[model samples]
Target: MSRVRNGLIGRGLIPVWLLLPIVALFAVGYVLPLSQLVLKSLQSEGSWSLKSYLEIAHSPTFFWIVLRTLTLAATVTLICLLVAYPLAYMIARCSPRVASLMLLVVTLPYLTSVLIRTYGWIVLLGPSGPINKTLLQLGVISEPLQMVFNAAGVYIGMVQVQLPLMVFPLYAALARVNPSLTKAAQSLGSPPTDAFLRVTLPASMPGLVSGCTLVFLSCLGFYITPELLGGPDDYLIAQGISLRVLILGNFSDAAAQSSLLLLAVIMIFLVFRRRIAEELDDSSRFDDISPLGATASGLAARRPIVERASLLSHHVGLRIHEALTSVRRPLLRFFAGLALLLLTLPFAVVIPLAFSDAPYLTFPPPGYSLRWFSRLFSNTQWLDALSFSLRWAGLSALLSVAVGVPAAFALVRHRFPGRLAIYLLLISPLIVPHVVMAVSLFFALAGTSLIGSPLAFALGYAIIGAPYAVVVTIAGLKRFDRTLERAATSLGANQITILRTVTLPLLLPTLASAAIFAFIVGFDDVVFGLFLSGPNATPLPMRMWDNIRLEISPQIAVVAVMFLAVLAILGLLRLFVGAAIEGRRSQAKT
Candidate 1:
């Protein structure tokens, strides 16, 4: 038995077999459903036709919606880049402890549900919210501004939600840059501003590109933020598709819209695929100086014109730098602090509003009370939704780990044909928009009895959760020391024994992180719940979405606070476990 197992492992058969489960899942859950969607889009009254496409091309409403979607996505991407660059740069230049704390602040809102964040914006930006209230008290404005339910609200909400996606990639890129290179440029007679522009900026291009691509792609598929915050005129493509299916009962039209949207996503993804991969793999060092040197030599040949232009710019930059030298650091700190505060503004507002004595949404409650908390707990609908969310999120995490762990092991431990293709297939969910996946899953499961079942929700959520699991686990496996496994083998242990005693034990931290990420993916999901969730299986996000769209109350804030409390508890527990583990390791070393 041991020889057979060893032979299978040696020949790479074990790794190949381990990949089969995820491959099968994607085939049934992703590929076939998308194929069905395409087919449905092509058929009209059971015959092939382009009627839906033709209608979309001719309809001014749809044309405007598509145009708006693209325009919004582009604008949001640009704004996020502008706002995130300075913050990321500031964080990168900080001490490691400070950088970690700043990153934690930036990422906390990201872990919260988009629905919750959008609600936070509603409370903060509404006429009765804090901003307008403060402005009124100070006599800044005669009346409250119409901030929500318009294009302004959409932009503000979308940017706040997407800011972290931009900051993280930019931080990663900027952090990898060698500080000496900037100093070297300054030493070679470049001004501080000029050095950053030519040296630091160019070095961070990979991250800039990655961050912009992610933000743009995400904005393109935004449904929750726009739906809850924007007016009817601010309609987007995702909303159009949802309307056609859910309200109009026109599956063909919805499928056609989804197909076009999916095509756009695929095209953009393919164009930036290589750069995105480089960023994710942390493989782009930006250390090659040959290109910079070549450009400089080329410029030297045209020095008469270039030198005059460069001299004027350098002189201007020097004067400006001198003028602002005393205030530059303080200015950067202020802007960066403001940006971080913007990221946490939603929770900062919502937590306080949860305790408001007022029956409705208000800032700085007349008096603090637990009425909303009591109401939320006593409400059956809220309890049922919360129950459903927790149960399915837990199941989804388990399902993701069960399949993702083996696939990670296979990809890391063995060389095989089609390995790259397999890895891509596993991570494709992350590339495809959540709305598109939700639509595809809806069509795929409609023919089965599982359409509104908890099992169906788990399966769909797992598809979204699995990519994070595979990526995190693969990273862990790569960083793991294989020597311990060899030592176990030398003790006459079989493959299974070695895996159980040496591999799994050491990989526990990685697996736990992966599971937490997967759980969060399911828990924070609103896109999937929009299309697939039914009366019995509605997740908490879905319930929250309903309340925000229909009624404005303090109970919603209570739910948001409760969810944040849960997350805080989980985070603290993780820190405690990590400290205990480190202490044990210290003892062993001693």
Candidate 2:
């Protein structure tokens, strides 16, 4: 039996079974739909043609919307980089305690729903919101200015939604910068300003490029923020495509538009992917090919006054640097403080607003009550939507783990034909924009009479959620020690026994966290929910999207707060599980 098992394993038949689930999910949920989408885009009058593409190309509306999306995405990327760079730099420079505190502040907004974050802007910029009301009270303006439902609101919401994305990559880049290089520049008589630009800034470029690419791509497909907060004439590409599908029932036109956007995403990623992969794949690249020494030398030579004065006075050269450092540190703190406030204040304001009895959105409520929470439980539609979201979360958690765990195992424990291709295919859902994926899946599901089916939505959610699950599981597997498994095998245990008794228990903590993350990813989904969900299976996010659009209501605030609560609970659960796992690991080591 042992010989047969070893032979099967040696032949790689076990890995084939291990990978079967993910492959099947990929083929049915992703590949088939994308293929159908391409076919749909090419079909014209029941015959193959580029008529849809030509029509979309010629349409003024399409052109403006595409231009708006590109412009907005680029602007948001730039703004997020500018705002987050200082914060990231400050965090990187700070002591570990301070840095950890700052990171917690930065990460808080991420834990909250993106829908809720957009709602935060609505509360701030509304006619009856705090900013306008305060201004009116102070006689700064006689009439409330229209801040919501405009380009300003969309920009604010999108920037806030995408800010954390930019900050993390930049922080990683900045934190990894060799301090010795900067010190060497200072020693060589280069001013702090020149050293930063020539040495430190260039070193941080990888993060800037990665963050900008990610934020821009995400901004293009964003639907909830723009749809909820944007004005009638402030249409973007995703909005335009959705309107075409929802209003005119024109899947072909929407597909063509989506395909165009997809092509752009592919093109942009091709331009930057090499840099991203280079930095990620080879951590030692910076150490091997550091430009800091070269940059500092050039800049030091360029500064004649500083070079000449180095003999006259060591302190004289540092005069500019001292003054600059003294002022710059405070300015960094002040702006970072403001940015943190901007991140945290909205959530703080909204939590109380949910408890308010006010009829409309107001900062200082007329009164307080639990009516909204009651309504959340009482309203059949709300309950139904919440129920479906919970169901979606559970099934997606299961499905993601089902595929993700084995995929992680295969990728980590084995190397075989098409390994890299398989890995790329598994993560390809992330490569395309969500709106494009939604448009493609929507049409593909329609052809099979599964457009509004809950099962179809679950599969769609699994595709998106699995990538994250795989990532989390892979991270844990990399940290796992295989010695325990070998010990179990030497004790006469079979492959199944070794895996079941040793591997599975050790991986449980990471699996649990991955499952919770997968749940949240499915639960808060709006774009796919918008395209695939309907009257029968209205996910909570889709319902929230509807509520915000058809009418602004307090119930949405209730839902948002509920989202935060669920995430908080899940976060605590994961922490507790982590502690337990650590305890057991310690016992095993002893």
Candidate 3:
């Protein structure tokens, strides 16, 4: 038996057993269902045909739904971009401490489930809620506005929910901008506005493109917000697909709709990508600027080929430059503050309302007490679901780390076939919508024994969370020196020994980050939990979903506040660990 195992291991087949759970998941959760959906789309009344797709194309309601979804997505993307750009820029420009705090605010909502966040939106946007109540008190309007159950409500909820997705990418892009460029621009007699437009904006275009692409793509497949907040006329393609599958019991129609949305999304991204690539390529073709046009008067070559500063900047005296330009930096700062406030207010709103003495959801309560929070602890249903979610998160995080660590190792340490393709495939989940995955997985698991099982949910979440683990671990591993591993090997260390001492120690910080990210991905997921959860295994987000749908409850606010508190604690821990790792690395170098 030992020899047989060794032979299999030597043949690269031993690890196959370790992959059984993941392989079963990918095959049963993704491949089979997608295949079935495609096959179903092909079948007609009795035989294979394009009839289902044709029927969809021919329907006026289908076209309207498609148009509505696109419009809603575009509107939300634009609004999010408008709101996120300045905030991201402000955060990136601030001191490290301030930047870290700002980043925490932007990312804190990410730890809480989207279902809870959307419910917060519901409380804020409802007629009797804060916005309308304030407006009525001020006599801005005698009657309440029709904000909820309309496109307006959907836009607010979706944009607020999805803004972080846009902000982070743009922040990353903006963060990459060199401060020297801005200084050089100032020294060259180019005003800050001109400098920003001519230099900063062009450099940051990649981030904007990336952020917009990510936000728009995600918005395209949104289901819950639109369904919960919007009126019947506000239906998007995702809602249409759900209606077809769940209500109408027409799997073929749902498949066709999903396929169309997928195709259109791919086409749209491809077109935008080509346009940006062409633009960049065209910019690269431009020759050196004329002496007359050179804003930088001095061009000094630090390295042989690349100039250290622009031509005009080289001429401007490095010191004793003119007064530094500061544009309505304050105005921009104020707007950034307002945007952050708007993004986070729903969460803030929940805290105060959670303690309301009245059963009704009211702010500035007649009396405040901890009774509701006390009630939360005694609510067995809520407690069970929360416990279930925590367990699922822990399990999923472990599984994600398991799959991700190896993949990260392989990608960083080895050269293999299809490496880039595999990397893209693994991270592709981040770009795709949750509802699509939920629908696909729903169909895939319909007849399988794995359906409605905790193991199945864990596997499902592992896939969703795997990319985050990969991102964090790869970042950590990339920054790590491979020479340490080589030295260990040379000292007669085995693979396990080298990994235990050299690799694992260096990768600890990253591992922690990956673990946190994996837990967040699983804990915050709503669509998957909604689709895959059984009575015994229903995650907190799904339970919250049931509560919100069945009736409006204030206990959700209590839950939301607690969720945020846990996230804050986790985030702080991650920061401290990261700092300690950095300190150790610095000390070692010293």
Candidate 4:
């Protein structure tokens, strides 16, 4: 039996078997749907043609919408970078305990549903909401300002929603930088600012780039925030696609637009693919191929003009450094605190509003009561939506785990041909925009009776969620010690017995984390729910989205609070599981 197993492993059959389930899931759930969408885009009246693409190309409206989407994504990425850099730096510089707390604060908004966050902004920025009401009361403004339904609201909501994406990556990069390098630069007679720019900043460029890429790509597909906050002119490409399909019933045009958006996403991924992979694997050595080194090498070819510009910038930097040296730390702390406050502001607003006695959304309610929570629980539609969301999320998590764990094993434990291709295929769902996936899935499922069924939602969500599972499980596998497996094998244990008795138990904590992540991905998703959900299968986020658009009510706040509560419970559960795992490990060592 052992000889047979070894022979199978040597022939790469084991890895192939392990990888098969996930490959099939991706094919049916992702590739087929997307292929259908592409084919639909190229079809006109049952004949293949370029009509839709040509129509889009010739339409000035399409041009502006695409341009607007790009501009919005770029602008949001820039703002998030500016706001998150200081906060991430501060967190990195703090003590571990304090840093963890601050990091949680930064991630608070991110953990909350985008719908809930957007609704929070609605309550806070509405004409009669808190900010305007306070301003009116203080005579800061005589009348309420138009804040919510405009570009200002879109920026605020998007920045708040996406800020943590930027912060986490930046923090990871900053935390990895050697403090001694900065000190060494200072010891060489460089100012603090110069040392940071010359040493720390260059080292953290990978994180900066990764964060920007994530934010930009995410902003491109943003539907909930912009739709809820922006005026008509603020319509983005994602909104355009949604309108074409949902309102106009124009699948071909929507498909064409989706194809273009997908193309842009693929191009971006290809451009930054190597950097993202290196960052994820922690394989990049900053000292060897630093951004500064790259710049210097590039500048070597155009020395004279670049040298003069560099000297001028250096002189200006020195002067600015001298002037701001004493207050620099204070400024960084202040800005970081401000950014964190912005991140937490929605939670602070929503929690109290959840208890509002009034039916409408207003801060500092005339009286406090549990009316909304009662209504939320009593409402049949809300209850049904919640039930469906929970069921679908569970199924999605289960499917993700079943498919992802073996793929992780194959990728991490075996070497084979097409391994890289398999890995890329598994993670490609993460690169594709959610709206595009939603559209593709919709097109593929439209002809089937399963269109709005729980199975449909589960399969769609699993496609996206499986990537998280694979990535997390791969990390766990990389950390796992194979010596224990070898010991078990030497004791005459077969592969199945070794896996059952040793591997699964050791990987329990990581598997649990992966499941929780997958569940959250399914639960918080609004795009898939939007396109695939029917009257009978509506998810909670979809329900909340409807309430947000049709009416602004305190019940939505109750749902938002529920989301936070669910997040907190999951987080505590994760910590508990991790501690238990650690305790067992310690006991075993003893």
Instruction: Say which candidate scores most in lDDT.
Output: 4
Q: List the residue pairs that clash in candidate 1.
A: none
Give Cα distance to truth, residue 206, candidate 1, Å. 1.2
User: Model 1, range 254-347, lDDT digits (tens) per residue?
Assistant: 9999999988987888788777555234233453434454235323332344335557797775776566655768878988988898899888
Model 2 stretches astray by more than 4 angstroms: 1-16, 136-143, 187-195, 275-322, 447-449, 479-498
Cα-based lDDT for every prediction: 0.83, 0.80, 0.74, 0.85
Candidate 2: residue 445 lDDT (0-100): 76
Which candidate number maximizes TM-score?
A: 4
Residue lDDT tens for model 3, 231-297: 9878788877777776788887887777776666656665565432321122332122333223332
Which is superior by lDDT, 1 or 4? 4
After TM-score superposition, the amount by which residue 445's alpha carbon in candidate 4 deviates from its true location, in angstroms, is 1.3
Q: Which wins on TM-score, candidate 2 or candidate 3?
A: 2
What range of 10 consecutive residues in model 3 has the weakest lDDT sum? 297-306
Runs in model 3 deviating more than 4 A are 1-25, 266-327, 481-495
Q: Which pairs clash inside model 4?
A: none
Worst-scoring 10-residue span by lDDT in model 1: 297-306
TM-score of each prediction: 0.92, 0.88, 0.85, 0.93
- State which candidate, 2 or 4, has the greater lDDT: 4
In model 4, the runs with Cα more than 4 Å from the true position are 1-11, 137-140, 279-282, 286-316, 481-495
